[model samples]
Target: MVGRKKRTTICDKELQKEDLISNLHEPLISEILLRLSTKDAVRTSLLSKRWRYLWQTVPGLDLALYDFLNINFSNIDAFFKFVERFFDSHRESWIRKLRLYLGYRHHICGLKSWIDAVTRPKIQHLDVNYYSSDEIPVSIYTCETLVHLRLEWVSLPNTEFVSLPCLKIMHLKRIRFTSDTTLEKLISGSPVLEDLKLFGCSNHNAIQLRSHTLKKIDMDMDHSSGFVIDAPLLQCLKTKIASTKDFQIISSGFPAKLDIDLQWRRRRPLERPPKKVIRDILADIRRVSDLVITSDILKEFFLYSKSRTVRQFRNLSRLHARFAICDIEMLPALLESCTKLESLIMVI
Candidate 1:
């Protein structure tokens, strides 16, 4: 009888330790629950009475409906409903970040409403990927507190007036702009933007990027167009151009890095780019320290060297060239121009 009493006493001590742990305050408990998926987070309420209302206060929401891709119609409908309920149950006054990745669908009104509801003043990061060709709601542009924004496969709103006072990083992929001036106006609105990336964007004749605060610019486009860069503070630049009609550089701070790839369509072979074209491009970025030039571009540069004067790349230290054996004749002239080149890479 005495041994049975001792066992009961030890069991009571273990239960007491568990009670102390489960009784942690809501903020601490919410942190533990926030790492879980939204569905799993919500399901925590069923664990015990102490956790019943704790999941509702999580500060961030990460909802990914990847299963929506393979699920049946009824399941998709149910999944959306579940999302609605989750949002309705969420009671956090300030959400730190919200991410949504969804497949192609025509749920415009629902998406607009959801965006309007979640884009509060406290939201700092917003990422949305909708594989459909729907136009993004203008409400996102008014997110004054957003620090980072990423959007894919969406058309930007056609609003002349845009203001993002705190945005710093913006990435757009497969985005459609309403007009030529749309991109310019959008960049102008973000007074303090630092990094910008554009990939596979459509519906623009030319992109004139003029910014004093931009530090990095990356662009990959399939269309034949030109770029006008005036970012004096830019440190890194990467671009893939389909045609070499014109690439104007007004001004840039150097000791930078440049990666350039130029390709010509097979059906329409472009005439050799003008000697002045190559000279102007090389002269503007002459201060770059690292450079990569593909075989096709080097061929044009080689042809240009035969006619025009080759400018010196005094600050260039590393050069990477992808060239054919026939283009080897240009290497002497190219290497002579780089007075300080320390490393050379020749890829066949």
Candidate 2:
């Protein structure tokens, strides 16, 4: 009778317990919370008192206001004001990143104060994208704690800002500088910098790079222009160009490996090897571990330098090409020169 009574009690509790746990629980993952907009974060206050303060301490703060959504411009100042208020009141100094991108050019003036307020010593990562006729504020450029920075479609003159000591990665897209030395000076200043990217900018004149700690560099060199690489610690390099004759690569030392992508214009005739071009790049690259050449470019390089010593092809592991509406001429000499080639890839 006692055993049967215990079994009967368990059955009765199952139906009662199911109803108690039916409510939906909030998600614990942080990514879902980050996707919510500032407005959505504010709305969370209605959930409970605990959630009210939670949004204030969130790691990421994005303050890019959509002007189209707001009917009146008068409310713009108020939005910026509220954001400034949040940074001031938040006590915790451990904010991981604070990203502020004010899209509209009209509100750039208001950013001066907001930038100064948000760049606390505690903030580790900061990204700002804005357009201004005035110069970049010196205080913004000299941020000691910033590790990654991106300046797009902006201008920074030479005389004002000199260096960024703590920057590790930088992306300058369509950025214009006043002079050639200005860009070089800024690059050399980042002593601990690792990666640098330049896309569609003026003054592609021979750039002298002197980074002791750089690792990767990707540059789309301007045709009819030349640039030099002098980084002692460079490991990977990717360069693409149209006029191979005009492009020159000067390296302090060749990367451990090199991957070249070339696009030949139909108008240029098949001509002799550009001795100046080949010599400039060879001066820096002491050894090329792997060479990936497009089919068209491989033909060009072979045509320019015929029967060159395959013995100098030291440490080369692969020779690959991609053919596009072009016949692959049998160049046994080209393959023979790569004495150490281990594999070849051909994609038609």
Q: CA lDDT of each candidate?
A: 0.74, 0.62
Backbone clashes per model, in order?
0, 4
Q: What stretches of model 1 exceed 4 Å from their correct place?
A: 1-57, 68-74, 105-108, 203-207, 252-255, 265-277, 306-314, 320-337, 342-348
TM-score leader = 1
Task: Write one digit per residue (lDDT tens) for candidate 2, span 103-202.
Answer: 6455556566655654545555666666656555556556677777776656666655655778899777666677788777777778888988777676
Q: Which ten residues in a row have the lowest lDDT in candidate 2?
A: 21-30
On the 0 to 100 scale, the lDDT of residue 232 in model 2 is 74
Model 2 clash tally? 4
Q: Each prediction's TM-score against the native?
A: 0.74, 0.68
* Tens digit of per-residue lDDT, candidate 1, span 188-262: 889899999988886447678888888888888656367788888888887776545345667735527888876
RMSD of 2: 7.4
